[model samples]
Target: MTGFRVLFRAACSRVEGTGHLRRCLTLARELVARGASVGVVTEDNPLARSLAFSSANLSVHFVAPGCLFADLIDDVAVVVIDMPKTDEQLSLHPDWIGQLRQADRAGVSVVSLGHVSASADCFRAVIDLYPSRTVHAVNYLEGPEYLILRPEFAASDIADGAFSDQCEANRVLVSMGGSDPQDLTGTAIKALIDTGVTMSVDLVIGSGYCGDLQAWQTQATAAGLELTVHRDLGANDMARLMRQSTLALVAFGTTAYELMALGRVAAAFTHYSWQEASAQRFESLGAIRYLGCAESVLSCRRIAEQVRQLLADRDAMAAMAKKGQALVDGRGACRVADLLQTYAQETRDRQLDLLYVVAHPGDELMGAGATLIRQIDEGLRVGLVVLGEGSASRWNEPGPSQDRELAQRGLKTALQQVADQLGLSAWYYYRFEDNRFDGHDRLDLVKVVESVIRRHCPHTVYTHHPADLNIDHRLCFEAVITATRPQPECPVTTVYSIETPSSTDWGSVLGHGVFQPNWFESVAATLERKLALLELYQSELRDDPHPRSLAAVADQARYWGRRIGVPCAEAFVLQRHLAATISEQKHSERQGES
Candidate 1:
């Protein structure tokens, strides 16, 4: 166990189909670099066979479709499945997954790696592309490994002048898996010629011997494009190539994530699949240039032209490579490694306990929602209990007051705005008398929250800042104090609002007035989102019939922001450390956690 001997089982068949095995090979190399005895077991999909032979630290063990689980588990302290959730992911076949579980039960730690391993609970440790929500790890499972990108990507130390010679400068690799059992390589070569000029061209052919690799080699040579048919390069080499090359004409698959990790500027050309849907966002981020697939060689001319343009601009390509690297650090594999290491080192019986309560829509949105989204995105266990009816009974509009629906519409919109902007979980709202927080029974408020805490047992609770100017905000704060009072041992981290423009005096909100705030927190990263959320209070803006309030709130935050040297910031009055409540047990727990 000290010097772990790990076996990586992967799915590698086609050129495009090789990401799973490729990344697994990357991980194996990482372990080998770390001084572990590493080996690989693959379906022997032709794409993966080369990896077995490439690394000195890796010993190859080939298995056929019908290989039994016992045969797959030979000489392995831990079995790491390196199959991602691409359309070509093959390791999760029921038979293989079942075998891995059996191996785990037999005391061989099962570590599942790849984007595609969804049921994390089934393995001792499951590593993936990013933090996963679809698979619950910290709770039901032993460990959750985050996909670690390779170091070659993070270091960005591309061999100085990997393409120094102008004659060999325009090199690119437009390689995917070998599922095309259809001879797309010949068409791709034809398409490359159609696009423009380049002396050195890397023709990546992985495990898929769809047709004759020899024939494609012949065609590639005839085109005068130096075709390097690499059947045996590890993921580390592939990552190097993605970074060293001026540009890559690739598809929406594991290669994309790898290039994204390497921060290699790439132009995507896909036929169509689930991966394509996510590619739209990748394109928006300028990580990829999209070109739809070609049914035949006739349609690849356009694809070639696109690749041609990228080749012409090395500077632009370098910029994209940096951007891609920023988008994904090769930490995914390391993330998985750490998780597995921790689990292999420890065993525990843990309980998830919590006490969570929140004020209705506006309070949660304006301040708490941003932090909540950050927590949720990290795969934490959390929920909110909002206390307010969807009514604006306390609102004092200049014009004729409207019905409950009309008044609450703005609040609802703002709440929705917070959720959408922060990508937070669906909120749970209650119809309590709004603007009348002062009248809500302290005991009743506490009781409702206490009931929720007992039901969910949340480890942390977030609430409105206790000393805020808004009467409603104050009450929301008080209710949480009362709820957590009984369960003094439970921990609740409280977060308060930066006074909203709607809750302020018109004079101060105008920015020229004297009600300027002295307190602020850098909300620079979330400023646009905050701006957008403020719009949700359409009722507030429309209440005056002038829509001046909309601009007023922004002006106030901006004024404070300018004073603080930040682009934008939200103001807060934190009194959680008041002398009177200094030693209060409830206050003590909420003190440092928040």
Candidate 2:
């Protein structure tokens, strides 16, 4: 019974804000890609907005917020929260805190997720602005263990790299706050020039400031300090400017943290009271220099000197950069996901259930990658089922000779290397002769897989995914499906794809605008083992593309690492998660009984 990781629900506050939903989506994608199923539980109010903002691949369900204290879902591995809850008064309600505590007590790791104002007592951990020494002030739990800092921002690796022309401009971004009530951009701009910095500025005003900002932009040109203003910097532009900024001058809030993470140090000028407190806290950590309200700070000649001090000395700049990143790691989403996946594996003995059915040489290695690492590191029992001899194609070559057959025999040797790496049982390969297709219809092949399923009676079955574009991958999906449909102990998970088997020759496939989806999986846990298994696929991914090449598989996984926000990933599209009948019900119940 692999549990799911869920995020908390809430309304009011910044329910429509993309920041909260963005974090949830990142974490969900990471956890779900690993073995653990990841679900999100958010309130209806914010969910509508998030739906427009989120990617369809990530699943987030809207449940009422009132059920906070209820033992909602037992199979949940962790609960993450960052939304604004209005059903209960956060300032006065002990119940809100109690709800989080209840989740912690249930052995479900609780993470009070945040970017700003990130201090949590009830959570097992706080995923937020990281590496900041301010995290050291948390009163409970091991600060380091409970504090999951992200790497993208925590380190200064990208600061000295590059910047946009506009970024280097005295472009001062003024995102008033997540929810800017006062619409304070005009006055803030006035105060800045009043300070006599007279630097050219690109103001990032929000969606709500259309008219006022337009008028100010016109005036900005006339005022003559070489000012150009932009309101609501479109997504791409905002990121570009942030990457290439001399400094970001925003009011104290999450943007401050994000800018800091981007290695752009910002000066804070608080408009509201809580902002003042946050500015103070950030200042204590050397994250930013606060200069009273926007109006007053904008009027002083001393502002230029302060800006020069921050800009001239790279040492102080780097230190401040690190301090800001200390608040949270950009990798928070991925790591939290891995943690929950490990939690799901903890139930293995209690549920001697799922058997990951593999095909060919690198099937298991490429598909169930993250799970393989956890299984081997913990010395867990894993059942292996290799479908064929995994031999290379002899379809077009000279009549199959003894030499070619020995290479065919190489499939078993390669598979053994895989098993040895995983510390798992030997391959129960049906030895139906590898890669050389025994002429058969999709249905007949299904029967053979069906026989395997009946004999194993595994609670969960992992196989090739149906929608896979490769020939054998397609065949595996159809066969696995036919074999598992009628029995009680049939494989619960019908399929997963091994991308290597579906390789495209670079010569035939280049210069085409075709989109390839590579599975993003971390084989690090069993990376050595995975490569060993690939050694078994004697005909896999050859560079010359003589019909077998696994290079595409590994290359694609590395490519995916750069996408979906990770370093390395082996991906598999999920096929099923349901109990279709009484037998399916009993199978699940039986898994629990074990």
Best by TM-score: 1
TM-score of each: 0.50, 0.46
Off by over 4 Å in 2: 1-3, 10-18, 43-52, 62-74, 83-107, 114-123, 126-159, 162-169, 182-184, 206-211, 225-236, 269-285, 292-329, 339-594
Q: How well does model 1 score by local distance difference test?
A: 0.54
Tell me the spans in candidate 1 whose CA falls farther than 4 Å from its real position: 1-8, 14-16, 32-41, 44-50, 55-68, 71-80, 84-153, 159-169, 177-184, 196-199, 212-244, 251-263, 270-272, 293-298, 312-318, 346-594
The sequence of per-residue lDDT tens digits that candidate 1 reaches over residues 1-594 is 356567777766653365566577777777776676777777755555655566555677777754533354565567776654521344435565667556655556666553432433335444434222232111111111133555665534444322233323677776755454445555667677777585566766655546677876676677777877675455567765765566666655556666666556667655434444456545655556766544323467777777777777766666665555555555666655544444443212112232224545655544433444445556664455566743556556644322332345446545545544554322344445666666655765655565444434554555655444456656766776776553455444442334544443433433433334445666556555655665665544443333235455456557667889987666654423223355686784887499
- Worst lDDT 10-window in candidate 2: 136-145
True lDDT of residue 367, candidate 2: 48
The lDDT of model 2 is 0.51
